[model samples]
Target: MVQERLARRRYGSEVGQWSGWASWSACSRSCGGGVRTQTRLCLEKVAKDNGTDSGDQPPSRAETGRRRLRPIQCVGSDKRFHMCNEEDCPPEAGDFRAEQCASFNEKPYKDRLYRWRPHYSTKRPCSLTCGPENASFYVTLRRRVIDGTRCSPDGGTDRADHVCAAGHCKHIGCDGVVGSPRVRDACGVCGGDNSTCHLVSGIFTEPHLREGYQLVLQIPAGACSIRIEEVVPTRNYLALRAGNKEFIVNGAWNIDNSGQYQGAGATFMYRRQTDTQGETLAATGPITEPVDIFLLYRQMNRGIKYEYVIKRNASLSSVLPRLPNDLQSLPPAPPPALPALPQLPARPSVVPRPTGHRNAVPAPGVARPPHTAPRLPATPAGAGQRRGGVLA
Candidate 1:
């Protein structure tokens, strides 16, 4: 009975004996669901003369009548944690765990030096597991990774949604709160409805795609929540190029694994499903540079579906409106005007002759002489019969 009473006295009530929480510790990371901690001490007040303190004894004796605080193991937890630095890490910054693994570059483990890379362990998410390039064997460098390191190697790229804290994985919602139910809306605004942005969607079915790479779409800067998919299975593959004509994905006719790729100051998630025979591209972005999507056609193309969100009041370029799709729809210019023809001589007027008469008619203004009688020769009467009585 006495021992039980003494034990209860040494470890006081959780709230009553504990001190107020100290200021939170520095965040474990600069971005991506970092964690901050606060700690409280379990204390018990005792007369200075008792000498029953839990820590080191004082150099000098204290007054008999005075009291001092002594720390004890409390019945409750001594530390508490909350999420911090929930914003996304920049694309160029790379992955936090990957950086940790790379720190062991040229490290010796099995009688040889090697370049190290992060090897994810689903069973122990918080462990720092590393492997060499192009090698399947891996080793656990540390039992626990630094707080704020991503729990999974491929959780995401744009943000650190899940992270390790105090050797445990913790989920941070889109609202940046731990264990919250909030999520991003269609516009990718946390806890918001779909009213913030407008949807832009279209299908490309050009009926004929050339034998090589062809432009499928040009996603402008300042667009958000972009998605592109090949709706029907085909031998064609998708490609991406920056505004400077630099290829971002599937360049040089090489196939890339489904993963996150950085370009145009944004990160794109590429997914290829062989089982479904479809390929998809997605991003949560307000990209800072324009990117053009291309289709590499080895065979016939069925169709591609694409959609994105853009704010209102954006200017649609009247100039080169058909710039997308390789500008195949522009009208042909008209032929140059023909040179004027040279002048020709005028045709002469024609006059008709009276039927059965060989003589040409006189001009209309000439007047004929008064009527004249017929005359016959007298000596020539035996040659022909005279028609009139004048001469026979």
Candidate 2:
């Protein structure tokens, strides 16, 4: 590879030829697989001017316009990416995309300032699109990301093996060669035989007893080329949890749509094939941490098949330690606590009412007023007899 790079550097340097490649730019990240880039120029002239060799000094922009020569396009790519700083970043260092978004934090946009966050989009893989935290809309902050950034670090991209080169997604291979055909085998070795690692696979057939989520299996740290798939579709879901017991996908009974999730120091591609009612989880990894696999058993489980590559000397027991009997089942959720009933003050007992008014008695603390009878009006003698003829 070094020799090929050196040869390309020398290819077009004879006067009026392509210029040697410029020094590579700084890496896009300090760690965690960032990119660096270098560029070359096409110096071949487009037109014969001043009766001199057209190659002798490529025409200046003004001269090219005057000559009206067809615009010269280079025969090959002028820019290329170099994968660099592949060492993993410390856990506390945070994410690279977030760092890019933070570059615009507190900066004015449309006369306003917002706490920006990285907005992922596979369509514009190399563009820096960001939005205010918790916002539904995003703004394309830059036409392209800094060269060397992964084309789509979070995955779900058609060009998973590409990176940004001069604002464009360009192919890169496991061998670090642009447009190289080399690919990693199932063992996750760039060019080694599949024999380098041992494949561990099993079909989990544990009956899901009264389910929400049930422990199915665990993939240990340092696992690579991990794949988990439902053997039969039952509208069931595959759930993943990190070593810390933090849910990675389909946790809390909330069904997540198909997408990439970050956990265990790797990106997991979780897909729900609605057409087939199938669910799958995959990752290309030597995962930095162990991950637990679970099944959301909405119905009777058919089976879940899982496979991953581990070091040749590693045993299945060591890589996938069995959970204790108590943990084999989903941890029971504490039932919602019932609120306490408020206490009421006691009421004084009421004395029985006297059976009759004769039994009623007045206490010494009260004095009763004397009772009086209602008065009646006197009637007139003539008014007592009927004045009508029938009454008389």
Candidate 3:
């Protein structure tokens, strides 16, 4: 029997392992669903037993007893097993639990994207429109409250109105008004304590549409000429000429609030006239000398309002004569003899009146009057003897 069993084993080896192949094919055909299900169940059982899933690295024997298993998907071209998709994975795999997705998750790279353009709205409607040709421009003038009380035109106390036409044109939405040029104040022109000159303050001229105009400010007393150092305008160029000299002032007009121009401080120079040139037909005429005058000018809407103050040198007193005779010598005086002095009689010597009171009377030793008088009984008979004898 031993000899027969040895011979049978030798025969099976020589049959090309047919039994192994047959067993594999039979298992595949007979247990297709059962084997796959069994294999998945066995993997899960092994993960639970070892504390690891097919997607995760196998836990150490010591940790396997305390850990749990997680699921994972196949990755990489080689189809090698890897840890599950969790924080413990290699950094190159990225984190799936982050709020913002990684750059790779977004579509259309930055270089391929386009930017949006901005849009603008049209301007708002204006409340006012263009005014007539003769209308004066109004400006809304505003100044921050600084050190002093509010200004005119409803500035101070909320009721006082100190605004001028020139300053009103620049105000917002003011279309300007049609009116005569009005003078704001006399002190605005004359630099003195007394602004008594009515001419100093008034609308000198009407506002016109002309580009260039001339206005003369008459000189007041106590000044010889007007001194003008500056001319400020809101939107125009100005030129000034006095005698043989001329000057130019550059300025601009603002229309955001009102449509007029106004300036605070400005000056102009003028000279008073010295002599007049009377008509003379002679070939050689008398020399003409220019007089000096002083003037002041203020820039306003439409035109410049002028205020003139004549400047005279205090040293000019030298040219005036000191004595009346010298002044009279220049011209003849009225003829008449000096009025004669009225004759007066000599005054009587003043005599003291005798006092009737005894205390005021002269003393008794001073003098006494004679008591007897001569007799005239024989005057008739004595007339015959008067030729021969002198009366005793």
Candidate 4:
């Protein structure tokens, strides 16, 4: 069989070349199991189809049908994904998409200029331009026809209903504080644009008054959720829910010392970490869904002021409770004191076995008793001598 195979190879049955793999594409993200892709070509098939040895491109549709479908299994899939860059967030500062959303804009729409805030929530739609500051002058819709609806009066658009009848709706996130940045595409780009993220901050009160509200925050990434870093030093009581889990934070300095009127009631603030000497802790979440952070507006009226950070594709298991690398510095605690050993009863000294000398040696620090030999009775000797004389 080996010889036949060698003969076939000599006859050029086995081509000298096979397709090689392509270079890997860039990683999809900085962390959280982002992916990269690469591919290989079926060089033999490409050569047979194009009458060329080099495999540069795929076979055309016509060419594929012209040849028998099962001519050969020469082609491989064009792409594959591999997870990479799954590292924890650095302890130091980095990009803050949340902060970028806290911007303001005054965009012109027709005769009126709309005061535009950063869009945070995903529930809103984007607007079109209308510039006609001059008489008989006006702006027009970028999409004169959207979803089969006309952008103009004759086009019969559903702009009044906030629907994209005239064209496909545009979901944008830029300088918007109310839009959900979490509604991004696979590339993490917001609103089909390179728009950055906005920070979701608000004061949640008990009975949402005209000015009060229940704070709702979107996670930084769908796979990785939000990280709420406490900004203020004071205690604040809060009840928040993400997915099926619920969380509560009572701002009282101490649980035993807290009262209804004492400290952080329903409302608090998310200040910077440098504002207090105590460690400004954070509430981490791998929330797969949106998080509702609010209070029962009726229990308390004041709102809690807070800020947050974004976490994407995070390693929930590998991350320590504290900041990175801080766990290693913790000192090893001393072992508990051991109970004293019990005393033993006194016993006779154990004498060492006799050495080559006449006497045995005593244990160190032990004294020995005096040694003596047994004596015979003098009467026995006198009796024996008298008996002998009598016999004579």
What TM-scores do the predictions have?
Answer: 0.53, 0.52, 0.15, 0.21
lDDT of 4 at 347: 31
Worst 10 residues of 3 by lDDT: 278-287
TM-score of model number 1: 0.53
Candidates, ranked, TM-score:
1, 2, 4, 3
Tens digit per residue, CA lDDT, model 2, 1-392: 45434534554322233578999889877887777778898674445432245676766889657534543334456777678887878989876777888999868999988988888777887799888977789999988877656666543366677777667777778888655667777766787778777766656644334556777666778789899887555556788999887899988777788888888988899997454446899998878888888877655555566778876542324444233231555676632322222332332333355442212122234232221111112323453322211122
Q: What overall lDDT goes with each candidate model? A: 0.64, 0.65, 0.22, 0.31
* Every candidate's CA RMSD: 32.7, 31.2, 50.9, 32.1
Q: Give the runs in model 3 whose Cα sits over 4 Å from its true position.
A: 1-199, 213-233, 248-303, 310-392
Find the candidate with the highest lDDT and give its number. Answer: 2
Off by over 4 Å in 1: 1-24, 27-124, 127-143, 156-160, 175-182, 252-257, 271-276, 311-392
Model 1 lDDT per residue over 220-290, tens place: 77677888887555556788877777888876666677888888877888876353455788888877777
Cα deviation in Å at residue 304, candidate 4? Answer: 5.1
Q: Could you give candidate 4's per-residue lDDT for residues 1-392 as a string of tens digits? A: 56534534553332223367789777645642234556665443335422345467766888657544433333234455444554544646332221121111244455555333222122222223333333343232342221211122211223311212213332222222111233443223444432332233332212222221233232222322233442222222233433334333321111121111111112222222232321122332223444444321222122233444332222321111121122121122332322222332333354355443223233255343222111111322223221211111
**Which one wins by lDDT: 1 or 4?**
1
Error of 1 at 188 (Å): 1.8
lDDT comparing candidate 2 with the true structure: 0.65
lDDT of 4: 0.31
In terms of lDDT, which candidate is stronger, 2 or 4?
Answer: 2
Better of 2 and 3 by lDDT: 2
